[model samples]
Target chain A: MKLVCSKANLLNGVQIVSKAVPSKTTMSILECILVDTTNGEIKLTANDMELGIETTIEGQIVEKGIIALDAKIFLEIVRKLPDSDITIETDASFKTVITCEKAKFTIIGKSGEDFSYLPAVERDDSIVISQFTLKELVRQTIFSISDNDNNKLMTGELFDINGDEFKIVSLDGHRISIRKIQMKNSYAPKKVVVPGKTLNEVSKILPGDADSDVTISFTEKHIVFEFDKTVVVSRLIEGEYFKIDQMLSSDYETKVKVNKKEFLSCIDRATLLVKEGDKKPIIVNITDNGMELKINSALGSMNEEIDIQKQGKDLMIGFNPKFLIDALRVIDDEEVDLYMVNPKAPCFIKNVEESYIYLILPVNFTTVA
Target chain B: MKLVCSKANLLNGVQIVSKAVPSKTTMSILECILVDTTNGEIKLTANDMELGIETTIEGQIVEKGIIALDAKIFLEIVRKLPDSDITIETDASFKTVITCEKAKFTIIGKSGEDFSYLPAVERDDSIVISQFTLKELVRQTIFSISDNDNNKLMTGELFDINGDEFKIVSLDGHRISIRKIQMKNSYAPKKVVVPGKTLNEVSKILPGDADSDVTISFTEKHIVFEFDKTVVVSRLIEGEYFKIDQMLSSDYETKVKVNKKEFLSCIDRATLLVKEGDKKPIIVNITDNGMELKINSALGSMNEEIDIQKQGKDLMIGFNPKFLIDALRVIDDEEVDLYMVNPKAPCFIKNVEESYIYLILPVNFTTVA
Candidate 1:
C-alpha cells in the first residue's frame, strides 16, 4: 500500500482511531491499527473488543493494499513530523514505511487478516442529533456512572429517547444525575446503556460546533455514533438498568434557591475538612436567615454560611460534598433549587429551568450532633 | 493567639511554610505548623527534622499567644477563603479557631512547645547573592542530582563558593550538570552539599524579581538561607563530591554547533518513537553533510536528519533522547556546541559562554550495523 497525505490530516485521523486501541491487551494484533489505502483515500480502524473506532481521510492512493501497524507509535510519529506531505508505503512483506521531509519511520506491520473484524451497524433505525448537544448531554451524565464491578448495570449511562427529546441518566447508588436535551430531528424511540468509558471517548473526539450532525444507530448488542468522518461503536451492557426515576423524591417540605458558583465554592472548601478513609459527609443546615454547611474530621472542622432564598422551616441534612459539587459543575444554570422533605430523606437538586435533576442520598449521621 | 490578616498574605505565608511540613511522619507534631501571635506580627513555622521554614507577616494581633495546627488543613482553608481579613484565635484548651468573612474553622491544636526548635544561623558567615542568578543556577544543575538512595552523596548538589564566584555541580554517574554564577559581593571560601529536596523547596518558595538579597550560610552540619521575612535551614549531606573537572576530556575529534531551539525540538520529536519498557535509545550520527538521529523499538523506528555546522571526522553516538533534551533546555545560550571524542565515550554539551556544562554518557546499542 502506498499513499501521500497532509501531516495534520493524517495525525487527526490516526488519533481518533488510536483512542480505541488498548495499551496492553492479551491479543497482540489488537494493538495494531488496520490501515487500508484504496480509491484515493486511507481508512484507519482500531478496536478493543468492546469498542471500535474507524476514521478515513483524503489521500493520494498510488496502490491499493492494507497493512496493520502499531496504533500508538504510528500516531505519535505522524503527530511529531513537521507540517508537510507524508508518504506512506507498505512492502510485499507488510513492512510499513512512513516518510516526511527528512524524517522516516519503518514499522513491522502484521497482515490485515490478523486483526479481528469489527462489526458494522445493521439497524435501520438511526437518529441524527447536533454534535454539540450530544456531547454536552454525555458530559453531564457520564460522571455519575459507577466505577465498581459489583453493580455491572450501573457502570453505564442509560439513554432514553422519546420523539425529539432525549434523556440520559447515570447513578452510583449514593448519587444520581439526569440530563435532557432536545434533538433537532426525531426518530424511533430507543433505549440503550452506553458504557461510561465509551461516552468519555466520544466527548473527546466530538467537535464543539454544531456544523455537523451525529448519526446514532443501535442494535441489541451494540450502539454506534458516526460523525466528522469517524465512527465509534460500543457494546451495550446486558442487564436490567435500575429505576433511577423511582429513587428520586416526589415531595419536599423545604426548598431553597442558591447561586451555583457560590454553592460550589462553599462545598469545595467544606470538603477540605472531610477525612478520606472515614465517611466524608458535610452537614447542610437550612434556616430562615440562610444556609450553613459544616464538616468535621480528624483534619479539622469548617462551617460556612451562604445567603439563600429559603421557603419553609429550618432543616439539616448530611451528604457527600463531592457528589453535590460534581452535580453542580455539570448543571448549565446560574442558580440551583435544592429541595428536601426531611433531614433523613434524599435531597433533590435541580436548576431553576427544571431541565435536569440530581438526587443524592443523605448519609446517616444519627450518632453525631 | 488572636490575629487578623489579609487573606492573600496569610495564604502565601502558610503555603511557604507548608512546604517544609512532612506529609506522613511518625512524629505527629512534625505535621503541624507552629503559629505565634505577638505584638503586631504573626509567625508561622514548620519543620521535618532535617529542614525547617519560618515566616512572619504583619497582622492585627489582639492577644499574644501560641498554638500548633495541621499545616495541610490551614493552607487549604486560607487558599479557599475570599480576599478579605481572616481572623484566627486559640482557646485556653489549645483549639485553634479561624474565621474569614462567613467561613469558620476549628482545628485541634497542640502546644507550640511540642514543635521542633529551628536552629539559628550565624549572620557573620552569611553571603548575599542575587535571587535571579541563584534561581537560574539551581534550575540548571538540580535535574542531574541522583535520585537513588544507594548513593547518598550524589543525591545532593555540591555548592562551591570562592570569593564572588559560586559553582554548583550535580551528577548521577550517567550524566553531570554544572552551573557557575558571579555574585556581586565577595565572601569566605565555602564548600557544602545541599540536599536536592532542600534546594527544591527553596526554588519553589523564593520569589523572583525581588530586589531583596538572599543570605546564604553554611556550617558543618547545616546550610541556611534567609530572605526578607522568611528563613529556611536544611541539614547538609556529608561526603566527598565527585571530581567533575577530571571527567572533562582534553581533546574532542568531532564537534557541532547548532541552534538550541532547533536541536531541542528535534530531540523531543525523536523521543516519541521510544517505547517505555524496551531499550529505546536514539542514535546521533554526525557527518560532513548533516546529523541524523535514529531510534528503533518494538513499536517502530524513526530517523531524522538535521542540518548543522560540523567539523572533523564523522561519529555516531547513542543516548537517551529525554536526557539530551533535559540538558539542552538548561542552556541559556542561543547556540549550543556538542563535543564528542568517540561513539562509545561520553559527549560534552555546553553553551558558547561556557557558564554551564552537561555531559551525557552514551547508551550501548544492541543492533548497530
Candidate 2:
C-alpha cells in the first residue's frame, strides 16, 4: 500500500480519529489506526469498542491496499514532519515507511484484517441540522449530565425530537438544562440517550460554521454522526431517561429580570470565598431594590449586589454557585428572567420562547457570623 | 489600619509576594501575608524561612498598623474585584474588611507580630546589573541545574563575579552550561551558589526591561535582591559547586556550523521517536556533504539530514536530545558552531566571543536493525 498526502490534511485526519484510540487496553490492536485504501479512498479509522471515528483525507492512493499503524507514533511523526507531501508505503510484511522532504521513518505495522471497524448503522433516518446549532445545543446542555456511575442513565443526555422542534435535556439530580431548536425540515419523531463522552468528542470535531451541516443517523443501539468528511459511531446507552417534565415546571410566585453579564459576575465574585471541592452555597436575596448574593465559608464571607427588575414578591434562596455560573456562561441573552416559588423551591432561568431553560434546586440557607 | 489602593496595584503586589508563602506548613502564620503600614507604606510581605518577598504597593495609608491575612484568600479576592479603588481596613481584633465598588469581604486575620520576617542581610557589597541581562543569563543556563537532591551542590548554579565579566555556570554531571555577560560597572570579585528554586522565583518576579536595574547584595549566608520597590531575600546554598572548567575546552578535531533553528527543530522532531522519560540519544554523523541525525526506539526509527558548512574531518557522535535542545533554544544567533573530538568525547557549541558555551557529553551508540 502506498499513499501521498499533505502534512496538514494528514495531521488533521489522524487527530480526529486518534481521539477514539484507547490509550491502555488488554487488546493492543485497539491502539492502532487502520489506513485503508481498498475502497479507493484514503480512510483512517480508529475504534475503542464504544466510540469509533473514521476520516478521509485528501490524498493520492497509488496502490489499493490496507495496513494498521500505531496511532500515537504515527501522530507524533506526522506532527513533526515538514509541511510538504508525506509518502507512506507498506510492504507485504507490514513494514511501513513514511517519508517527507529529507526525513524518513520506518515502523512495524499490523495486518488491517486484525483491526476492528466501526459497526455500520442504517442511515435512512438521518436528522439534518446545522453544525452551529448542534454544537450550541450540546455545549449548552451537556454540562448537566451526571458524572457518577451510580445511575447509569444519568450519565447520558436525552435527545428527543418532535416534528421540526428538537429538544436536548441533561440533568444531574441537582439541576436540569434544556435547549430547544427548530430544524429546517420536519422528520420522524425519535428519542435516544447518548453518552456524554461521545457528545463531547463530537462537539470538539464539529466545525462551528453556520453554513455547514451535520447529519445524525441512529438505530436502536448505535448512533452515527457524519460531518466534514468524518463519521463517528457511538454505542447508545440502553435505558429510559428520567422523566423531568414535572420537575421542569415554570410556575413561580416571585420573578426577576436581571442583566446576564452583571448577574454572572456577581455570583462569580461571591464564589471566590469557597475553595475547590467545597459545596458551600451562595445565598440570593431578591427585593424591590436589587438582587443581593452572599456566601460564607471557612476562608471568608463575601457579599455582592446587582440591580434587577422585580415583578413579584421578595424572597431569599440558596444555590450552588457553580450550577448557576455554568448556565449563565452559555446563555446568549442580554437579560435573563428568573422564576422562583420560594426559598426551598427550584429557580428557572428561561425566556418566553422556551429556546433554552435551566432549572436549579436551592439548598437550605444558614446564615453564619 | 486602613488603606486605599487601586485594584490592579494591590493584585500585582500580592501576587509578587505570595510566591514565598508556603502552601503546606505546620506553622499557620507561614501561610499568611503580612500587611505592614507602620513605616508609612503599604507593604505586603510573605516569608517561608528559606525565601522571603516584600513589595510596596501604591496606596494611601489612612492609619498606621499591622495585620496578617491568609495569602490564598487575599489573592483570590483581589483578583476578582472590579478595577477601581479598593479600601482595606483592619480592626484591633484582627477583623479585616475589604471593599471595592459594591462588593465586600470580611475575613479573620492574625497578629502581624507572629509572622516570620526576612532575615537581615548585609547591604555593603552590592552588584548592579540590567534586569534584562540577569534574566537572559539565568534563562540560558538554569536548565542544566540538577534536580536530584542526592547532589546538593549540583542543584544550585554558581555565580562567579570577576570584575566586569559575570559568568554563571550550571551542570548536572552529564552536561555544563555557561553564560557570561559584561556589566556596565565593575564590582568586587565574589563567588556564590544560588539555589535553582530561588533563581526561578526571582526570574519570574523580575521584569525583562533592559532599562531597569536590579541591585543584588550578598553576605556570607544570605542574598538580597532589591528592584522596583520589591526586595527578595533568599538563603544562599552552603557548599562548593562542581568544577566544570576543565571539561569546557575549545580543542576539537571536527567543526560544523549549522542554522540554530533548523538544527533545533530537527532534534525536536527526532525526539518524537521516544516517549517522555525515555533517555534516548540522537546520533549525529557529520561529513563534507552535510549532517545526518538518526534515532531508534521501541516505537520506530527516524533519519534526517541537513546541509551544513564543515571545517574538519568527519565524525559521528551521540548525545541526549534534550540537552542540545535546551542550549539551542536559548542561543540568539543565526548560525551556531559545533566542535566535536570523537564519538566518546564531549561536543562544544560556542562562538569565538566566548560569551556563551554549552558542553554536552556523548552517549554510547549501538547500530539497530
Candidate 3:
C-alpha cells in the first residue's frame, strides 16, 4: 500500500475513527486501523464489533492496496510530524515506511485481510434530520440514561417516530427526559432503542451546524448515522422500552414560573452543603414570596431564596439537586414552568408547546434531623 | 466576629492561604483556616507545621473577634456565593453564619485558640528581586530537581549568591541545570537550598508582571517570601549540594550550532517510538552536512536529518530524549550551541555570557542491535 497525504488531513481522519478503537482488547487485530487505497479512495476504518467508524480523507493514492497499522502509534507519529506532505508505503511483507520532509519512520503492519469489516445493513428505512438538532437531543437527554447494565432496557434511549412528530425518551428508574421536535414530512411509525454509548460517541463527533443534515437508517439489529464524509454504525439494543406515556401528564396541583438562570444558580448553591454522591435533598418551600431552597447535611446548612411568579396552591417538596440542575442547565429559555401534584409525587417541568418535558421523582426526607 | 466583604477579595485571600492547609491529617485544626479581625484587619492564616501562609483580606470589621473554619467548606461557600457584599458573623458558641445577598450558610467553627500560629523568624537577611525573574528562574530549573527523597540534597535547588551575580543549580544525577541572573547591588555571599515543593507553590501564586517585586529573607532553618499583602514561609531542606563545577567545561572536541525549535521538534518526533517509562536513547551523528538523529526501539525506528554549522571533528553520541526535551523546552533562544568531547562524554549548552548552562550525560548504546 502506498499513499501521500497532508498531515492535517490524515490526522483529522485518524482522530475521528479512533473513537471506535477499543483501548484494551484480547484480539490484536481489533486495535488496528485498516487503511485501504482501493476503489479510487483512501478510506480508514476502525471496528470494535459493537461500534464502527470510517472516513475517507483527501490524499493522492499512488498504488491501490490495503494494510492495517497500530492506531495508537500511527496517530502519535502523524500528530507530531511536521506539517508537510507525508508519504506512506508498505511492501508485501507489511514493512511500512512513513516519510515527511526530513523525518522518516519504519514500522511493521498486519495484513488488512485479518481485520473485521462492519456488518452490512439495509438503508431503505431512512430518516433525514439536522445535525444541530440531533446533537442537542443527545446532550440534553443522555445524562438521564442508566450507566449500569442491571436493567438492559434502561441503558438505551427510545427513539419514537410517528408521522411528522418525532421524540426521544431516556429514563433511569428515578426520572425520565423527553425531547420532541417536528419533522419535515410525515411517515410511518417506527421505534428503536439505541445504546447510550453509541449516541454519546456520535454526539461528540457531530458538528453543531444547522445547515448540514444527517441521514439515519435503521434495520432490525443495526443503525447507521451518515454525515459529511464519515459514517458511524452501531448495533441496536434488543429489548422492549418502558411505556412512559402514563407517567407524563399535564395535571398539577401547584405550578410556578421561575427564572431559569436564577433557579439553576439557587440549586447549585444549595448543593454546596451536600457532599458528593450523597442524596441530601434540597427542600423547596414556595409561598407568596417566591420560593426558598434549603439543604442540611453533615457539612452544614444552606438556604437560598429565588423570586418567582406562582400560580395555584403553594406547596413544599424535596428533590435531588443534581436532577434539577441537569435539566435547568440545558434549557436556553429565560424562564421555565414547573408543575407538581404533591410533596410525594414527581415534579414536572416543560414548555408550553411541549418541546421538552423533565420528570424528577422527589426524594423522601422525613427522617432528616 | 462580624464583617462584610466583597466575595472576590475574600475568595482570593482564602485561596492563597488554603494551599498550606493539609488535605488529610489526624489533627483537624491543621485543616482549618483561622480568621482574625482583632488587629483592625481581616487576617486569614493556615499552618501545617512544615509550612505556613497568611494574607489580610479587605473587609469592614463591625465586631472584633476570632474563629477557625474548615478551609475546604469556606472556600467552596465563598466561590459559589453571588458577587455581592458577604457578611460573616460568629457568636460565643462558635456558630458561624455567612450571608450574601439572598443566600445564607450556618456552620460550626472551632475556637481560634486551637489554631497553630506561624513561628517567628528573624528577617535580618533580605534580598529584593523582580517577581517575574524569580518565577522564570524557578520554572526553568525546577524540572531537574529530584522528586524522591532518597538523596535529601537532590530534592532542592542550590541558591548561591555571590555579590551582584546570583546563580541557582539543580541536579538529579543524570543531568544538571544552572540559571544565573545579575542583581542590582552587591551584598554579602550567602548560600541556601530551597525545597522544590516550596518553589513550585511560590511560582504558582507569583504575579508574572515585571513591575511587581518580592522580598525574600532566609534564616537558619526557615525561608520567608513576602509580596502583595501575602507571606509564604517554608522550612528549608538541609545538606550540602553536589560539586558540579568541574562538569561545566568549555573545552570540546566537536561543536555544532542548530536552530533550537527545529532540533527540539526533530527529537520530539523521534521519541514517539519510545514507550512511556522506557529509557530509549536518540543517537546523534554529526559530520560535514550537519546532524542525523536516529532511534531504534521495539516499536519502530526513526531517523531525522537537521542542518547545522560544524566547528570541529565528527562525533557520535546517544542520549535520553527526555533530558534534551526538558532543557530545550525551557530555554527561550532561537539558536543554541552544543559542545561535546567524545561519544561517552557529557554535552554542554550555554550562552556567551554564561547566563544559563545545561549538561546532559550521554548513555551507553553500543550493545544494542
- Winning candidate number (DockQ): 2
Error of 3 at B328 (Å): 0.6
Per-candidate TM-scores read 0.94, 0.97, 0.98
Task: Flag the better candidate by lDDT, 1 or 3.
Answer: 3
For all candidates in order, the CA lDDT equals 0.86, 0.92, 0.92
DockQ of 1: 0.72
- Per-residue C-alpha lDDT of model 3 across residues B1-369, encoded as one tens digit per residue: 999999999999999999899888999999999999999999999998888999998989999999999999999999999999999999999999999999999999999999989999998898888999999999999999999899988999998999988899999999999999998888689889998888888888787667898888999999999999999999988887788887778999998999999999999999999999988899999999989999999999999999999999999899999999999999999999999999888898888888999999999876355
| Every model's DockQ | 0.72, 0.81, 0.79
Candidate 1 segments whose C-alpha is farther than 4 A from its true place: A238-250, A367-369, B210-212, B277-281
Clashing pairs in 2: none
DockQ of 2: 0.81
* Clash-forming residue pairs, model 3: none
| Model 1 chain A worst lDDT window (10 residues) | A360-369
Question: Per-residue CA lDDT of candidate 1, range B152-263, in tens?
Answer: 9889999999998899999999998988778888888888899999999999998955476788887788999988799999999998887878888747899998888877
lDDT of 3 at B155: 92
Q: Residue-wise lDDT of candidate 2 within B230-285, one digit each (tens)?
A: 99999989987777776677788999999998899899889998889998889999
What are the per-candidate TM-scores when only chain A is compared? 0.96, 0.98, 0.97
Score residue A47 of candidate 1 by CA lDDT. 94
Question: lDDT per residue, candidate 3, A148-258, as tens digits?
Answer: 899988999999999988899999999999999998987689999999989988998887689999889999999999999999999999977899998988899889999
